[model samples]
Target: MSEENKTYTQEQVDKLVQSETDKIRTEYTKQIKELQEKLPPEKDEKEVDLANRLKALEEREKMMDVQDELSKKGFDRELADFIKSGSDIEKLTEILKNNQNYIPDKHKGTETTITKEQFKAMGYSERAKIYNENPELYKKLSQ
Candidate 1:
């Protein structure tokens, strides 16, 4: 049973979810490719950050491949964006694979995905704090 006037049936909802997930995955992949091209092999910090972000996005694709048990709850766009911000690919990947309300994958010892909202929910005020702490590094990174 769906909410009042919910036009989407279970099957329709599933397809729509799949489509959105697929789109995110494709966009993430495209971003990764772009970042890889942008990366300077000589180890520029910003380049590395961009590369790592790309890798994190690549790992995020697996979330789309999961059985979306929370279809009723709909996907969290903010959470999805937050999960992509992970510093290390493996750490972020681990978190995404273990989030609540969402269905678990067959593979155990998985990483849970984080959403932008979840990150916000977790209260990360560090970005500005870090920038304020080190204006020069922040300026360089921003450039």
Candidate 2:
């Protein structure tokens, strides 16, 4: 039939329009997909920022936990940063126990009192030893 003479029913006209629309839609979809593949994947700024914040918060929590554990174990909480044992409290405790000797003891014994006359009688080496041990006491005695 001649195209000009051809008459399409409503159903036929609807089908033709639908088929063309589908083809155009498919072609545009394919083009969009291809362009997307060629371009770098976009990073969601808010998601990345949230992930970083979460990581920081997790680290802070872990550090605080370690400090609390240190305090409970009678170790200096300041040692939390120096602890190599990640989350293993047992290993941390063992390490602290083994190296307990290295940690300074804050408890001081009664200070030995010496009269100025006794200080004067001390040799240079003795005075030097006392000075090295307690400079304040040495200064007091020396004066």
Candidate 3:
């Protein structure tokens, strides 16, 4: 039959369409697989968020433990924020010992008599120092 006059039967046309559809589908599937292989595997959002929150909580717990250690060692609790030893009490103690000169003495020389006016005029650190050295004197002055 002439090419112009040739016509595909219903079965032949359906087969042709199916073959073309299969090729296109296969090509798209291969491309999707290749792209997936090239990219890093994605983590679930909920899992990632949970991991971050757990990390934060662990850090906070370490900090709290360090601060408790500092208080136990007669150092200021506030110093825990500055310390980066992460929960190693011995390391923290060694650090404090090495930097003892920088840290104020909790107990200095004998307490001297100061009036209420003088105590009131003293800054927080000075007052804290006096209180640390002698609670009775601090109470008397404060009263």
Candidate 4:
């Protein structure tokens, strides 16, 4: 057996993890401070987290990513058009109702797509359908 592949003791792993964490903490503190300062005063941490959440989702795509699935599910043009075309939150929520499963792993566990149970949780009832069985195009966005 290779010496490197041999199981390391738990104590050894803990030391390595602690060292890497300390390194990361020193490197990230500056950026965290800057982000905290730049955020608007009226915005709460949860709101900022939401914005960051969407930004992160928009930043990275899985192999069969959110956009790809959404396009395949025929939800992209409408969703993009909704967000870009200045649709209201209610309108956007309605659009999200389509393919509740159209949501990607990256956005799973988020309230991005609203369902009947979700609507009930929020005291909402119905939403407009916006699913296309098959979209003519499946384009990936640039990071």
Candidate models: Cα lDDT each: 0.60, 0.86, 0.87, 0.55
Instruction: Compose the digit string of candidate 1's lDDT tens values, residues 1-143.
Output: 56875687799999999999999999999999999999876878998999999998877664443323222234444444333332334464456667745855664653654344443454337546546775664455444
| TM-score of candidate 1 relative to the true fold | 0.25
Model 2 per-residue lDDT tens digits across residues 10-113: 99999999999999999999999999999987869998899899999998998998888878877788988787454566687787689977745577565677
Ranking by TM-score: 3, 2, 1, 4
Can you give the lDDT of residue 5 in candidate 3?
Answer: 97
* Residue-wise C-alpha lDDT for candidate 4, range 1-143, written one tens digit per residue: 89878997899999999999999998899889999899877878999999999887765533224445446555654354334322343455566687555857875664554444553444212222222321221111101
lDDT of each residue in 1-143, candidate 3, tens digit only: 99999999999999999999999999999999999999998889998999999999999998888888778888888887788664566787788789878835765664666889999999999999999987999899898
Over 4 Å off, model 4: 1-4, 37-143
Model 1, residue 10: distance off in Å is: 1.2
Clashing pairs in 2: none
Model number with the top TM-score: 3
Instruction: List candidate 2 stretches off by more than 4 Å.
Output: 1-41, 84-89, 95-143
- Stretch of 10 with least lDDT, candidate 2: 103-112
> Order of candidates by lDDT, top first?
3, 2, 1, 4
- Model 1: weakest 10-residue lDDT segment is 64-73
